[model samples]
Target chain A: MTDALQTDPRLLVLAQGDNIAVLKATIKAGEDILIAGNEVHVGSTLGLGHKLAVVAIQGGDDVVKYGFPIGFAVADIPLGAHVHVHNLASRYTTVEIME
Target chain B: MPEMMAWPRQDGRKGIRNVVLVAYLVECAHHVCKQIARPFDESDVQVIGFSGCFPSEYGQDMMTALCTHPNVGAVQLVSLGCENFKKSQLAESVRASGRPVNVVTIQEAGGTAAAVEAGRAWVAQTRAELQNLPMVAMQPSELVIGTICGGSDATSGITGNPAAGVAFDRLVSEGATCIFEETGELIGCEHVMAERAATDALRPAIVDTVAKAARYYADMGYGSFSNGNATGGLSTIEEKSLGAYAKSGQSQICGILRPAQRPATGGLYLLDVVPDGPPKHGFPNINDNAEIIELISCGAHAVIFVTGRGSVVGSAISPVLKVCANPETFTHMSGDMDVNAGRILDGGGQLHDVGTEIYEKLVALGAGARTASEALGHVEFVLTYKSQSPSNPACYPN
Candidate 1:
């Protein structure tokens, strides 16, 4: 990956205050990525279009994206960890994931 | 200053294309209607129909609106002769609209072969005269545009939806009529959306529309959220809604509209797509094409469709411009996409830059350009049973 792709907000983050950033490409476990001018280590392999926490989020904190709260974190999420159905939940409707 | 070359209608609305429409009044007549339009394929003789044999006011109204749609120059009504679809009344409405209308009863015409031959002959005769219909020039202010997103993902909100939003904003600024809809998917952004209502009367209506959608979904045991949405990294309906809501841009909500209802004077109107009262008709919309047909029924000349996971659908009457949001999806489906809003995610330009690209493209489409879906002949259409109360008078207070 090029340094420019890592630093571009278009490729990494959508808005300034969003706690989570979407992946434009897949990343392997233990790979390092940059977020808000800081280097963060990827904890798991996540595919393209998945999201990851850009900042440390405590349990029950609002997960922000597009400068609005999409939902809240269900557990204490460390920086660069995956923020998904297991770790995040909606405040309005139940997220039913079919097995 | 973009101008559209179009066919003028008696109702004072203008159509971007003058294509003949062959309509089936019931599912039983669908085959003959399809066969009738098949011979005129690729020349804009399109087919649309209602599948329900049982009588429905909603179904009748939708068929009437679609058959008399501005894009349609003439219509052929195919009926099975005993299906209670109100074929005569539908034909009268089309005739009243000052468009050529024909009715071919399969039972009366001696069978499928006879009916198809009769319908095809009328279509051929009608298609010949469409070229001579008086043409008119329409300004951007006279154009009605619509927006919807399907097969969406995380990249949708970040790139494609917002870019379409920007284009929506630009079009609204130029005095074009613009609409965005499906209140069922906008469950979480009610309060935020209400803040932009143009009138105080419209505020509560906005909130109530979303609340109705929430209640109906709760009763049905399913939200508009889907498994594909979940796999695409959308954790909840709220996340998907927040992204979906971005397609409206930042315009003040001018009014609320029901299916077959056009905006009185459009800035940006929210189409209340969820059914009123109960969840009797199952899901408010069966799929994305249903929503597209609703928009076309509301007088949109063309629609803006954004996607992240990727969709390749275009409606029967109006052109659907596909804006691909994910760079990878765009790479895989480049031939099906009209705008590469995904480039915004690849560090090509700002979201507004793509917004500008979408705006310019809509103008080109108005000036007689074919969208990717249009060029590929994707005239997919659907109109299912649905219920909507007439618009509240206060929702459109002057």
Candidate 2:
């Protein structure tokens, strides 16, 4: 929405030390985007509020956000890949929604 | 800081709303309670009931807390004459607080019809006394603030929640007691949350309660996390927890406050909503409002409710100030929300700006400004049976 935001991170980076960045707008696969001055290609189509791998994540490694481990990657997650339940897994079992 | 008109209580806690509470001791007495409150629908007189026929330690403690909640000016108890809901004890407590309390028993009052008549008359008399109670201007330090999230969406985590977190931080720094609850929902955030504990002793309680929540939900066959939460893009319980935990901002978590336990000091507190033992009666919270009631019982003067998908519910006594996160959802449910936290996503405003607005809105609401839900008379209430020992010593008031 401003020149500062565009040149800053290209997306919403919650913390400076965080690995994942939340998408401010939807992104399509193969689009080149500027992230904190680093040019990277979008690896997948992602929806808003979805997380994108701003850094390379190896299998069995913790995925950090909010400066803490929210979950771990089940497989290799490349830069610009959408991180979700498919590749990212919660260490705890997912629960049922009663209603 | 804005000045607030406070209704002083004998215990020195004070209140923002001079609400007349009509409480039903059992399911059977619910009808009489409803009938009495219906006539006064335009008034601040509200109805809350304990729906269990059997006795429970948690239920008893909850009832006592509700009767003595800071928002209450007077209490009216309706009993079926045969339940263990503790009408006498509640009345005795309110009466001791120097507030007018009227108890009507259905069996002695000649059934529902007669009890309703007596209850209505009692409400009329109590309402006058409630209005006549003296009001004084107070500062922010005298306030106890509570926050909760319902029905999250993607925008909620990134906008509404973070905004509320900012407000929590500001409120705590200003010397107000701030509380955030739902330990069951914070399963994955145990480590991160533990890092903010104010002391070494408090860290274990925070970790253990979250573990307790995880075990209880595991046995219940489902955690508090829902499909609605998933559609919001949260992949796991921990992810949702990080969002929920954000409402605490960066304040040091003083200690764990169980249901109906008030914080002893002015600081941020985490309410452990999970029942102490294995799950009993039903889910720990029947819905979001049940959890809201628990916060009220602990003496919250007002509640900051953040909703991303849009929730219209409000509390009976303590007004619920809603902060909506989704711009589209806010557009549709603008009438229900008090603050547009979605401005952050739209880039119209930042988190601190919205948080500052929430803090100011809280002060205005304390000055007798009605919230959207309160103006619409959306008084949603629920209380269920559960067993638990009293809160651990760390949680008691200073």
Candidate 3:
């Protein structure tokens, strides 16, 4: 890998102890980046501000961000996987996504 | 010390802008009021009103607060004569504030044409009289600022909202009264906020207010989470709340303010935008402008609006500084934005850098520099029916 590509940081961890990190910019599938001491390959294209798991989250586990649990995972979510409405559900209010 | 030359009001408040407010009593008189104010620039003559034909104690209080707002130099009330809003009583309240007040009823004035003519004549004269309003030296401690995050995306928490929080912290430390609202959006951060309360009694008040919002939204079968919020990558209400909560900064929240109620001292406060009872109103706020109007009614001289999805709405009586959170959205809607907090996320600046920029811009705004929305004539205003009782004294221990 080139020096510029290796040095660029793509994910932003808002606070310590946050299990998920936000994407600083859009990234295409197959891009490998180091997160939490692990180099994880991107499984799919993710847009800016979208969340990615810094650590593997099991089914029914809480998705933590800003050092607080934002929601619980509906299913098992692997590290570097996208965390969104599909696998996450609100702890307070239901996110009724229209099909 | 941050200070500016501001318009001094009889109520002992300072206003960043001296405005001639043309207020319509009901939806029936809206067109006439609009036509009356159409001839003048929005900066000089701005139209604001309540649309409900039925009487609402909440609506009445909001109108009274808005019409007597320090920013309003004079007011002209347009009434349809049949609506339940007591126009004469409103006129009396406006007069009591030591401002010139006029009322024109469409039924008594012979209809739309005559009413519009009378309203325009009054507004024209009021505009002339507003030119001689005294400008006094005002400090940051004398200012009341409000903040709201609309069209939020994930960028809001990390970039825009946190930057705004920095600005709020600075303003609060300077002894300026700073308010942050939209309790419906703060569904899951109640405990976090409670910990930041100034007094022990305020903890329950803060916790109870968020619970009220959670229950209200549950009954309505909706949280404040919109499709745009999800599309922008916010998955749930709790997730959005965590992000929105960052806008409050780390200051000790001194009090909780209900709509149309002013804070007695300069400090950090939380505004409960949701109604007191169950979901009587469709939503806590119909849109961002409603919350902005609520903040203005409580005496915000200017509002700091943090947006990730890029909201362009401004207020009639107060200035709205749009802090765009997403770098991509800022690139697309630069004309509508003031501060580019997105730069922090883009690796161009630190969070404190953007926060300081917002703080400086607000101080400049107080010195008569118009916000991007204000300069673009985005005078969007809204007020609807909602019920709220007086706040508990415990919430304001100071």
Candidate 4:
């Protein structure tokens, strides 16, 4: 990570209870980030406005954001891994209507 | 504070702008209505329509509410003569409001061109009548304010909506009636909002409305069912909701209102946009402007529209104050945006500052400032079918 990353904010932490942080810019794999006094390596291509796992999430665990539950992780999401639909599923299920 | 002047209506309501509206009763009359409004070449002359031919209770209610909108000084209804839009009901309500209304049926008026010419003369005459009505000074207690977030992105949660929330706080504190809607977008926020309810009875309705919004979205999902989750910011409904809920500020939700229903008095109110009974079989809001139109129907003189992805929509009667949440998007679409709440993310300012900016912009708008969309001639209005539950006293216990 460059020294510029220390002075400038690249990731946003919305709430203290949120378990994820959003990237302000697109991040490439192997890039280093400093957040919440911890230095972590980016594990995948994290797109802008996309969520990053700030903490470990076991399978079926809730993915917390903005101090509330956004969804559940479908897989064991490692810290620094990309958090998206591939690993997360909506907590609310769709209701089917008969024609 | 500068004293704001506004168009005075018969029902003790004030309008931020004096707009002569040409309403198309159905899709067929839309073009003729547009032509009728074209020659005026003025922002105050606007066209709005309900595209559906089959009459809907909610649609009729919206048309009546819109015709009686405080900003609308007069109305010209363009009817195809075959559709069941109930022009008589609309005309009666508009006339009762003491506003001059002209109904031109294409079948009776020879054709489209003849109807347009007739509408033009009626519009000119109505303009003269509107000039005679008294213009009064608007006070905070007399103002009806509304806020909505559109095309929200990641930055919206921390910046745009929260700033709007702060502005809402100031408005509510100033004794101005404030409203925020889109219960569907507030899936995860029912509990928090209900807890802030002024009346204990309104709490359950708040929760129930959120549930209805969720069910409606769930039932109306696309075949692939990726409803804006692809936006790369929001992963689930709750995440997007948390962002949406921020727009209410910290004001106690004094009451709840159905679509097109005005508040009984001035305070913080929640507009429940979810279909009340059996589903309406159509989208709750066809677009952002539909919600804006509903706010206008509720007598909102000015609308503060916060957008992160940059929506350029503005309403016909009421002026919209566009507050951009994403700085990058603001930089890209600055021409469409009025205030840059994105400055918080760009490190130029804070949420409270953006809130103050929004509050000032709204005051200026009410004082006759032309928004970017209004200056550029973007009067995007839409109304679709939606049903509501039986009205409850709890919805408006003043």
Candidate 5:
């Protein structure tokens, strides 16, 4: 099992082989991060429960949740960038963002 | 696989109980039906009715479905002489399903007193024969279960809903029929849900149903997603919908059913609670109990209800298993809850552990064990008039 309590202060992977890890606490840019056994610099700050991709994702790439595709990335999301409604759009029904 | 028990009916369907049903055809016949059902004094012989005077194809269809439901072994129809609800047709449908059925009219029998006496005798005889029916092995695949969440708070989305989602995933994998409803609660997440459809054809229906719900609630001068929702810390309807959608687990969306429409196959099916067009008879469902009635009409054997603020209500025909998600609410209202998914939030248990507990409880209930609601004799049921066009041809095979 992946360590539930990892050395990283911000995020933890819930399941092994998962492409994304959940932020355990708010993370800031330029922080040292360990994801999928690799050390990388945080690209951006992210809130708790928000997702951070272990690898870089390009525009129109599918975002998986619960190991299934929930939506697609609307723009290129760097590794450790906060992944949520802002960067992702549902592939099924139109979601109009309120300005 | 472990062997499961069931009440085998003559019609080839199996049930956990062999119930004798007393049905009221209209509002006027309700009292007589209740009085007649009283003599049986057993949960297996329960009274269920529709209180409408006008003719409704929907009402007729639901009545037939309930009267011949797998759990029902026989039926008695109560009618007032002047109502448009056709007592003969209703009784005929039940009889044709291979169940014994009879009808008694207050006007013909002289009054309520006489009709009640006649109805009581008929019920007694039917109950005797129904008790003798053979028990058979019921597989998990034959079970039809429904789920709904009410009295929701922030904790609902985080714990209880996802826990139920875990149970839904297990049940669907076993080939059990699972249904989750309330499109109004699912306003913002429709696009995400539509993507899970089993086919490309069902995608539009998914969008249309959510659109229909949005328009219906908008016309009422309120968002189907409520302000109380915001107070509960749910920022938008879409966010609330993401939580509500969690109840379906990670299964493929099999099909869509309107109120009382049974699914063609077992899996995760969505029940569209919104009316087809404009609101006709007030709100789609007055409250949670009304939603429960729709679940029963769709042939659910039981319901798994998730709540955060606390809900003490339970349904009549089917058993209700209450799951409490908030640690504080669970502490305050422990008596009302059957499972404490909130334990996970308290760091006392894991989500998978609580989910496994719920799944085992469902299996026991499906094997003739009575839930707290069923033991309390809370067999609350109701049917109201609403219109629906037949399902689209592309949605089902002919």
Candidate 6:
């Protein structure tokens, strides 16, 4: 395993064999992130410590964290797009968004 | 099957760590107890205590639970001579559990200087005995973990809290014990929480506990749901409660645990934080650290702390894994937080990914890896007297 791959600036994999990667720092819209040898543009301006999809996801897809589904995507999210209330909804109950 | 690890005590119950706990019998003896624990410095000798002048059955019960907590292998009881605390009963209960226990009264032992010296010697011996004990392999099923989110904001509900819930689900499914507490914060979601209870009897108990918290806080001239919560973007208590409830991870509520009470079996349990009666006690939990201390007394091996505004406090006995939900807060307080659930809010990661990371971190901690708080030596602990009758036989089948 390459040390560069493990400490990549764009994404951090906390556990081995996990499907998702956490952003180490924010990526502005149109910023490119290299994951799995592919570079994808940042769809929305993600704040520092925010999340972006490392892989393409379809509408109604359940977003997985800690290896379990926390909620579902409200819209189709392209690779490297921000994943928050704008694109996701809690599976248990509805939440209000201010703004 | 999930693997398990345990430190076998003289008693049959398995522990994750062999700890020597120094306990202050009353608020009066706290200084001396702290002095004794200070010398051991990272030797697993944690200081925990009861801060009551007048004797209460609840105080004695909590002391007994803490002294004999699974993580604790030995105990030193520090007393100030004229207190009404039943030090004998407290010592006996711990000794009966087959753990080493010592009681030293400052007045009888020739005051502060003499007591500190004697207490230090005792701590050295306890630590010596604890160090050589075999470290057994522990499993996820053997762990009793607790979750509490303090200083919450809107991001807490959306990100860190739900991420914790995802982790809780995985642990419970693996036969690990998990507890989620703070009935006051859970006021809005009691109905939803009750629906997940293992039995119909527990459903009403769940609702009643939140109602009790509401009344208790209301009598104190402020709602238990704080104004800071609103400043952090929470509109109503229900909104906060709904978010706080996510930490339970959709597991069936197994049983209700009183402060410092261990579950008879592994699964998800709700801790009832409200006092049994009116506002005799000033506040149910004075602060976040008090809540964390109570969970430790109930035998939690560690805790998952979710926050949006950012809480830096940790417990004395159990290691706290801080999960930051607000991306901005995570940026500012990155050193203090262990997991950045806020990434989910920024669209960098999904809930399940963070949840799995937290679960794996929990396992790693159980395997003896130090958490951010543990590595930073944030061993904060507090205990105070509050009254509560035993749970109804129907609620907790002994």
Number of the top candidate by TM-score? Answer: 2
Which pairs clash inside model 4?
none
lDDT of 6 by residue, B82-179 (tens): 99999999999999998889999999999998999999999898788877777677777778889999877657777788789999999899898898
Model 4 agreement with the true structure over B1-398: per-residue lDDT tens digits: 56688888889888888899999999999999989988785586899888898878888888898889888889999999999899998999999999889899999999988999999999988888787887888876778988898887777777888899999999889989999998877877688688888887988978988887777776877232244545655666566677788889888998888877889888899887777655555787878988998888787888889888889998878888898988999999999989988887766886778899888878877676788888888888888777745567876766
Off by over 4 Å in 2: A1-10, A55-62, A72-79, A86-99, B224-231, B394-398
Instruction: Kindly list the per-residue Cα lDDT of model 1 for residues A2-74, writing each as its tens digit.
Output: 5445552423666778888877767888877776556877778777668888889999999997778888999
TM for candidate 1 is 0.90
- Provide the overall lDDT of each model, using Cα atoms, as 2-decimal numbers: 0.86, 0.83, 0.87, 0.81, 0.76, 0.77
Q: Number of clashes in every candidate structure?
A: 0, 2, 0, 0, 3, 31
Of the two candidates 2 and 3, the one with more favorable DockQ, higher being better, is 3
The residue ranges of model 5 lying beyond 4 angstroms of the native Cα positions read A1-3, A6-99
| Candidate 4 Cα deviation (angstroms), residue B181 | 2.0
Q: Candidate 3, which CAPRI tier?
A: medium
The residue pairs in collision within model 3 are: none
Q: Pick the candidate with the highest lDDT.
A: 3
TM-score of every candidate relative to the true structure: 0.90, 0.93, 0.90, 0.86, 0.82, 0.79
* Model 2 Cα shift for residue B326 (angstroms): 1.3
Task: Please give the RMSD to the true structure for each candidate, in Å.
Answer: 3.1, 2.9, 3.3, 4.3, 5.1, 7.5
Candidate 5, B1-398: lDDT as tens digits: 34668777666667766788888888899999889988665576788888999898888888887887877788888898899987788888787888899889899999999999999998888888877777888887888888999988766766788889889889899998899988877876777788889888888888898888878877876555455544443333455577777788878888888776777778888888777878776677778988987887788877899998898777766778989977788899887788898777566677788778788888787665677666666777766777754766565322
Q: Pick the candidate with the highest DockQ.
A: 3
Fraction of native contacts (fnat) of each candidate: 0.66, 0.59, 0.69, 0.49, 0.00, 0.00
lDDT of each residue in A2-95, candidate 6, tens digit only? 5346333756543344334555455677766676656676666654334556667788986654344446778897766666656766564455
lDDT against true structure, model 2 = 0.83
The alpha-carbon deviation from the true structure for residue B104 of candidate 5, after best TM-score superposition, in angstroms, is: 1.1
Better of 1 and 6 by TM-score: 1
Give, for candidate 3 chain B, the lowest lDDT window spanning 10 residues: B223-232
